[model samples]
Target: MAVRPPQQDGDEPDTLEFGIAALSPHLSKSDLTFPATTDEVVRELGDPAIPYDANGNTVRLSEALGAVRATQFDTQRELLDALHPVLEEYRESGGGILSQLRALLPF
Candidate 1:
């Protein structure tokens, strides 16, 4: 379950804010807060332990740039290969929630 931070009224800017920034143009003034630090932000959201290095130093999300590194593996290809048979099975079963979800995928 994703836990959102408590909302504050007109506490800070959009870019620097967390929950509000994520919800963006859709968020109301009542749904905002002034998070003093990244720790505060993380605590409010009930996130799991922040990623860290082998040295036990806390790793900031911005600093962990390599986390998004692309690999030789093709994610789309892997997903399609794994899901095709399950989708086929759902179709043969006269369709259900899995079939509906499969239909919604851009693939």
Candidate 2:
């Protein structure tokens, strides 16, 4: 059965599909803690590890002048920063992923 929105007296029920950002009006969305510079990203990401090569070896990427890279991929902040733009794009396209993601954001 199709779900129905809550109704008010003499008023039309809100039926517009809102993206995660819109739905999460109470959520704290900020990038104040994110890496602003690519250097910061690389530093935060840390050195890459090699399988079965635990000699404190660090992987280096070719200089891309202005790129963000970080070894802290497991952190919620990093993940959020990386996915925020993509989520925003989806949200703009009226895709459902943004809403789903918004519900799970600030992880």
Candidate 3:
């Protein structure tokens, strides 16, 4: 996704958008729903080329959230990481332009 930082005058940033992978192995038989898994979520929306400070390290949401709660970093990267997949899912499920625009807003 094109993640634009907040503007100086407190206005919204330019659009940030990206594609998510299809729900494949995670899909269930009933209605083809996929259980939200960290790996699947990350794989679908993560920027593989982007460098992570922890390098090859990976962890589940619970673990990541725990770390965040403990103030591992001043801010939580996991929140941003988690939002991408959800936004992708909403877009793919036929969310309109307004909805997409809302999703692009910084938290």
The prediction achieving the highest lDDT against the true structure is 3
Best by TM-score: 2
Could you give candidate 3's per-residue lDDT for residues 5-91 as a string of tens digits? 445665653633232111211222223213434444344444242211111112233333332323222222444444445444433
Prediction 3 TM-score vs. true: 0.23
lDDT of 2 by residue, 1-107 (tens): 01244666657544432322222221233332342444453354442221111111111321221223443344445544554454344434433454456647786
Cα TM-score per model: 0.21, 0.25, 0.23
Candidate lDDT scores, in order, read: 0.32, 0.35, 0.36
Candidate 2 off by > 4 Å: 1-74, 96-107
1-107: candidate 1 lDDT, tens digit per residue: 01333457677332232211222232132232442233332334443222121212232322221232322223324322333343333224434465456658999
Assess candidate 2 and give its TM-score to the true structure. Answer: 0.25
How many pairs of residues collide in each model? 1, 4, 0
Candidate numbers sorted by TM-score from highest down: 2, 3, 1
Candidate 1 residue pairs that clash: 8-32
Clashes of 2: 4
